[model samples]
Target: MSKLPLEGYRVLEWGLWIAAPTASMMLGDLGADVIKIEHRVTGDPSRGLDAGYGSKTGRQSLYEGFNRNKRGITLDLSKPQAKTVISKLVQTADVFITNFRQSVADRSGLDYETLSKINPKLIYAVITGYGSKGPEADIRAFDGLAQGRSALAMQAIPEGPVWVRPALGDTVAGINAAFGIVTALLVRQRDGKGQKVETSLLSSLMFQQTSNLALHFIGSIPVAPIPRTRPTNVMLNMYRCADGKWINLYMPEADRFWPNFCKAMGIEHLRDDPRFKDIWVRAQNSEALVSVLDPIFASKPRHEWIRILKEHGCVIDIINDYADLPGDPQVIANNYLPEFDHPNYGRIKYPPMPVEFSATPGQLRRPAPEFGQHTEEVLLEVGFSWEEIAAFKEQKVI
Candidate 1:
């Protein structure tokens, strides 16, 4: 196999939770030598959270998902000696990432200014809940807070604001941070100098909701929460089948797909009906049309409806739970979810990073490390001798 795209890059990450750590993992997947720094006492807090994968017992799979392809070490930064270790790592690191709050970072002496002084060519990437200079920048936040602040929670449920599951804000922010870091690396390649790259959960969430934000802002329309019973477009909505399985139809261009969809759903006469004649009329009478179509859809099982709808070329998808995804034909055939054998957990599968390069394709290098698993190995690489490493361990600094 060809060498991975980022084979020669080195990343030093002090990410505590999901966003910054996940960004480093993305680079690690592409073959960066990522050394993740954890608290000597507890390590990454994620290590304790439910991984929700692998066997019922063992390491947290969620942490494994975000942290694969990287080595890990623990350091008690409160010890002055830890600064020398970080400075040594910074000297050769191409990228340095952290999600520490402004005050905490200042106290720890890991801010961009401090690290940049140590290595002018380092790409310093920072992740925050809000933008760096904002009034809320110092305030603590998490995935749900960003979702609520960005209006995602309000849009998800019109009845009342509720947090969206799966930590979407954190995931998106991590992807955005990765994009920023990569762009900075490109800039360094051209200018022989590195710069600070920054992204925030709030900013990422806003970007994710730009389409709706644009309509509300640029179009001079106040955004309203969409009720579950109504759809902005009748052609794109979820319907339930007799077997209680649900499917989604997403024929965006109503005019082109209406006749075919109606025929496939066994409602051909409705295509010519006066109330449902065109896109405008159908939309105006969406409730009535939905009332007519719901029973027809409920007349058959989801699988049968999927078969018929697909045969007619109507854009549709089955509403699948996370468990259904592992056995999904498309997911398997396309290698969207890749499987691996964990020594302790047996065989396991995780979602692959979606991007593919014809050459230099990324792969999982290893499973998430045990806490402080590589402290000695990493310290040796950074020039710490065995005697000094042992002393550091005794002093509770690694």
Candidate 2:
């Protein structure tokens, strides 16, 4: 294997929770050397986040999940001595990422204008709740608030508005921030100039819903919550099997797959029925068609239906829960979830970088660091002597 795509890059991250840290983690996964900075005393608040939902893991899982492939250091940014360390790091960093509000960044001298002076080629990325400018820019927000404000919550559940679990908004914003940072890095490579790159939870989530939002924008159709029971396309809906399991069909091209699908369900006569002849007519009579098809699907167990549909080349599969993912053959073949030997947790598995490269593949080289684990080591690399490090520690500035 060749060197990873970002092997020579250096990233400095001042992030909390998920967004900015997740962005830096992506860069680190591609082989950048990421340095995570935290408050000397409290560290990232996510270190204490509970897994909840009856998960067996403790609070450390959240922190470990977002912070792997990075070095950890602590510093009191408010302290005067801490400025020296930051300035030195900025001078050598190729990228700087922060999820701090504008005011907080300005106060800590971590703003783009200040850091760009230290390293003109630095790619500075910032993540926010709303945006850098606006009345609500500085207002604190988390995943749920972003989902509600961005209208994602409205589309999440059929009955009423409800935020999606597992921090959809934060994760999207983080991925967007990473893309922006990588784009900026490419631009810097061309022009030898650094620039500020910004992303927000609201903007990311809005972009995620672009196709649905365009219905209202261009077609005069109002975007609304999708009803699972009454699907507009009967061929593209889910049905319950005789064994009380669910199977989903995704035959979007109704005309192309009509014969095969009908043949698979032992309802080949429906293929010529006028009310369900074409895509449009089938959609118009979807409820009646669903009524006709649901019983046929429910006549067999999920595995039996899966086999029959697959044999006929109808696009169908059994619906899987989270527990089904680990042993999934396709997932294992693609290495989507890779196992790692963690010092504290023993054998564990987590989702790796999503993309694969033929020549420069990514690797998970290290686990998340312990609190301030590499403070002295990082300081030494930045030209700080043992005496200075001790003094900084003595003054609570490390």
Candidate 3:
């Protein structure tokens, strides 16, 4: 057997969409025995939303990307019989997660009050749009809404504040929620009890904007158009090499590169030039300096510039796109991806857990399950007799 850090840990993921399920998926990545509990018939809405795979696997990309190691069981918790089944499963679960509105949890009897009592050591984690206590606690939220609310859009783009292509809020919230659960698990190990660990899109977005938040709080003006190209280091901007490929130049300010930055563009005399002397001066005269440096960089291909920069001890990195990612040396070096013999999708390439350990490493135990795949097996394990399980299935209750 492989040595996985969370080999025996059991997690019951009741999440529907990305933010909630992605959290459990991280636990699954860490080798937790994650059991995803979904509705009986419809299943998780994301499981079949994408089009390229046809009906056989609509949301394969969504599920395969996030849910690599968990088992699935569909239970209509809205139904009394399913709720009873869930309560029994709660007793055997180490963690429980949900993302519905507070009222919905309260109504469904799946809130902390009910489940925590069933299993006092359960690490209950959640991700919401707003918090459960704020004025908008009950209101539903999505990544775009949180991004718009957190002013993340305004920070990145000057004109209209564009969102990143993927859902940033959802991913951030999911990661935060997963960390909170892991933290709470540590606390439980120490105290022999569990507590609620929760995160919200609003909170995650706030965490993402710590610098901007501090600036606003302290009344400092924040500049716009915060692409990584224009970093705090004035000489460390994106430069188009002679080949017209852009690469990032990160370096210590006022170092060897500072002199070279000016000389490479035939502006060595600018080293003593007042407007090009210090970072502040360079920032103030950004247009003037870049105007000189930009063309020098545009003269060569990115690889050629990288070679020159390496020879000159200029810290730099090639800007990589998706097409250039598969062969990225570092990704392969760390074995950051796993190949799976998926049932329908053979030899699928799924991202492996990002964490590494010397002894107790994380693992990928199973492929994402088929819809309602473990309904009968899970219900039976929860103490439902065959006759009862058959009746429920016949009634469309399982």
Count residue pairs with overlapping backbones in model 3.
6
Expressed as tens digits, the lDDT of each residue in 57-160 for candidate 3 is: 43467866777788888777677777778878999898998888788888888899888998989888878888889688889888888888887877765457
Computed on alpha carbons, the lDDT of every model, listed in order, comes to: 0.88, 0.90, 0.79
TM-scores for all predictions? 0.95, 0.94, 0.91
Runs of candidate 2 exceeding 4 Å displacement: 51-59, 272-275
Q: For model 2, give the 10-residue run with minimal summed lDDT.
A: 50-59
lDDT, model 1, position 198 = 92
lDDT of 2: 0.90
Off by over 4 Å in 1: 51-56
Which has the greatest TM-score? 1
Number of the top lDDT candidate = 2
Provide the lowest-lDDT 10-residue window in model 1: 50-59
For candidate 1, the lDDT comes to: 0.88
